[model samples]
Target: MLADFDDACGKIGLQLNLTKTMFMRNGWVPDAPFSLNGTNISECSSHVYVGREVNMMNDLAPELGRRKRAAWGAYKSIEDVVKKTKNIRLRAHLFNTMVLPALTYASETWTLRKQDENAVIVIERSIERVMLGMTRLTQVRAGIRSSTLRQQSKIRDAAVYAKSSKIRWAGHVMRLNDHRWTRAVSDWTPRNVKRTTGRPSIRWSDFFTKSFKERCDALRVSRTDRTHWTTLARERDKWKNCWRPLGLPDDQRESRSRSRSSWALVPPRKQEAGVNLSFGVQSSNKRSFLHFLSNIKTVSVESIFETAFTV
Candidate 1:
């Protein structure tokens, strides 16, 4: 036990003290005064002693001052680095904990297999959005680019990936264990097989693939819905006439999408390229991929969602 204790302490550079000291001795009252008189006055006399209550207090100021100075110097050295920091969320995600490990399992077992490309795309786009907003906000708030927002977004993306990964893993376990859920989908089960009670189930593909696709599709749908809201709100006059034929109320379209306390401001949507009859070129009519890519970190095609979509 002693050896193990010392070894553990050594790993974190902890110190041990076993020296005999005045404080450890009996009758060493730390804050009390002492008095002394001539020993010859009386053999039965109890002498009152007077001296410094605590000499260590006087002696330790210099040591304390040195420690304070060292700490301040160390803190100031990282002042510039801290000032340039952005994502607060990423820091929490990188820390080791039970929740983080679960997320890791989920990402590896499920989310990674199917929607790895989409995850990369979402992360890249999210970074660009944050950076663009931060750049403008920083210019106004601090009168300079005091922090690199792109760097922070990467941290946030990494954290999100960790969390999403774990969710995918957990979901895989839940799906396998649920008897009714698995049995409901016969196609998912193999042919020429008979089921026994409490039989173990195996997922053929990576668990993350389906989970990743679901998450990506949901995000895409949300973006599309918001885009439609923006179009309707902006072109209210055109919407009144055009959308009325499709049974959408002209007067309630704007109010239906918003509330008194909440106003819906649309974010820029990523565009996929397809041939347009109105234009001679095969180009995206919405946001340009390169323009958005420049704001984020990497420019890999796999990281961007501008791939050709087929029906």
Candidate 2:
């Protein structure tokens, strides 16, 4: 790995700071020690790269905290304007464009479990409660619903927004040239690794298949071709929503009904092991080798997800 990196750096007229660039790995695999250019590079438990924290265990708590703090900063930066503005639409728009983006930055790649999703939901609702000028105490006393508050402010659901972003990115990845690492990594299956009995670790791909359960199954079955997918589908007027088996996957639809807690979303049903969706999806085993190459993996995160809005 080091040799290949050194060669690439040499070609690009770049030199890696061996002392500063240490080794970091996700928890999915055992750690492997290494020397760079025959010099040993010290190992570390965790490191922050391009703003997101990566750790040996790939745990998301610290990253969530970082995003939460960033989101708070975004809100506080415009607090006066948002709180003072009488136009609810503008306040909601500001939150969606600024605060939500901070909270969900790089969210498409997140592999969150139910508790994590609930935690994110709580964070969003906390901000939303403030947006509506409703304190936690007042909300509890009045039995106010989260949906009611969001409806007034036109706020989007955090979980739904993140998941739909993933869906969109999946579409973009599906249409990529086969030679691309992002495409190769998405399609790569780990032949050496075997599943241990009992439970399995989560993958980013699970974020899509496990989201809507049977509705997703039906979606893949109906739209077996990539061209029919909302992201890949070019015929917006014809086959755009056609891939959505039940109008919009329930998770993607903004919540409009009264729910005491915004976090009361349905738990994602576990996919039966080895039962792959019919969307021609493959196992994603990117972590084993791709983390070291993430800087050059895709065209750009913004380009991938932003184009989905066009479809």
Candidate 3:
């Protein structure tokens, strides 16, 4: 394969940079050595291509964090202008134009799981909080309502934005000719490859299949009719509004709140594991400590010590 590549490149008057060349394994396969011009090629788990990270596991957390930081830098540059502007609509427009692209750059290629979706949402909400010039604690203390803030900001959900982008990219890819490399790969299925024992890792095509089935049930009809697919994919407001029904449920929100609050409490010490710290004790002082701990719902010994020391 290397000899063929060398010949092809030589015919084209192009030379392959052996030092920059590296191989990445896609599945659970043992690493093997490859040599080019007597130079050994290094194996890598992931590689950066066209500013996007490609990896075997397809984890987007690091990429998301990088995008978030870049977006935050963009936000900070115009933050003063945002704060001085009384027009909430203009502030939102600036944010959408300036910061959102950074956050969503190359997002069309991402195969997002629930955790990745949540991470993006958290970043969006945090930025919105900053735009509103209020911290979470201050917002709670001042009796400032969430609905009011959201109405004023007019910031759409990041997840909805990402989903729309991905769907649009898919539509674009679908329109490409079968002769194209991307189109060919998108449609190809490997044959004669030995199967691993466990469940196979989800591929991009698999993710797209599930997403398209759920979101665009009329995909087959749309494929037959280009105009219909274009209308569905190109209409931004319609697709954005489609995500309303997919919002997190009230019970899930409550559970998330409980989980977050749980972080405030310290865990029990190893030495105190066998000790009974229940409220049935006769001493009034210990009863108060137990009651406080129960009410707070935190189980950490560090928090207990901090609370006791503060008191």
Candidate 4:
């Protein structure tokens, strides 16, 4: 593919910038250097692309550190304004628009772990405390709650904002076109990968799954929907069919059709291309896909009444 790309670029009167081009090898790359048109391309341990840092190690600490540095820098720059300002609204605006944005840059893309969330929460609270003239000693001495500090400052918690952003991004990804690379990459599992003996990496999609129980456990609290969480966990094993990938098929008809992906924003109501569409939606000349942001809908009072009467 590299050779073909080189050839195609040459035909189009363009040449590769050997010095500028660099490749990141994930793990155990070969001794032979990868090249384009006999010119060896540089390999890098890390590179900042369009602001975000990409590391060969896949460790998120560096990116989080970068965000921290940026946030602190932004905060320090406006510290005088925060300290001296009589206008509470102005201080809040600056914090939200400038300082918070720096802190949570591209946070929607972050596959955050519990530690990462805690880190963000701490940073935000620390900054808020500084603005409110509350030192660590004072915060502890007064026995002030985080909720009280947020109420005093009139600023939302940064960690909560980040989680909200991430969940919203997840929904957007769910509604993405099947052909979109974002959707494809979300579902793609690496083939022939060796399993290390430890806890599996957290998946972004786990927000929609039974893993919410684990999250609540980590938070050391239970939501109002505790029973609902338990139900999902119990039903996972109960409801699943014997559709193991390694097992022999019951019959050809029983096998899931692969002509279309099982995921969709809206399930098809009619047949298409001689196959059951299932949850797959095809191309349409109707309303704009972007016009409607998410498929999640709330039942109105009228709808509840209508359904109740119909029932």
Count clashes in each candidate, considering only residues at least 3 apart in sequence or on different chains: 18, 1, 4, 0
Candidate structures ordered by TM-score, highest first: 2, 3, 4, 1
| Candidate 3 lDDT, 2-53, residue by residue in tens | 6566778799899877788766554444456667777887777766654555
Stretches > 4 Å off in candidate 2: 7-13, 26-32, 211-213, 216-239, 242-311
Which scores higher on TM-score, 1 or 2?
2
Q: What count of clashes does model 4 give?
A: 0
C-alpha lDDT values of all predictions:
0.29, 0.59, 0.56, 0.55
Among residues 3 or more apart in sequence or in different chains, the pairs in candidate 2 whose N, CA or C atoms overlap within 3 Å are 27-56
The 10 consecutive residues of candidate 1 with the worst lDDT sum are 44-53
lDDT of 1 at 310: 8
Point out where model 3 deviates above 4 Å: 1-15, 28-30, 142-147, 191-311
Q: Which regions in candidate 4 have their CA more than 4 angstroms from the true location?
A: 6-15, 28-31, 211-311
TM-score of each: 0.20, 0.69, 0.63, 0.62
Which window of 10 residues has the lowest lDDT sum in candidate 2? 259-268
Tens digit per residue, CA lDDT, model 4, 163-238: 5455445445555554554454555565655656798665555544544455346456557634332233233221
Residue 116, model 2: Cα distance from true site in angstroms: 1.3
Tell how far residue 254 is off in model 1, in angstroms: 44
Cα RMSD for candidates in order:
27.5, 9.7, 22.4, 18.8
lDDT of candidate 1 over 1-311, digit per residue (tens): 32344456579997423231012111122333221221111111111112111121112223223323433444344445444555444332322222223222212222122244344434334333433454445555776432244333222233344433333323332333344322222114334444546943323233323433454465675644433322332342322222111111112233221221211112224221221111112222121221121122222222221210100
Per-residue lDDT, model 3, residue 289, is 31
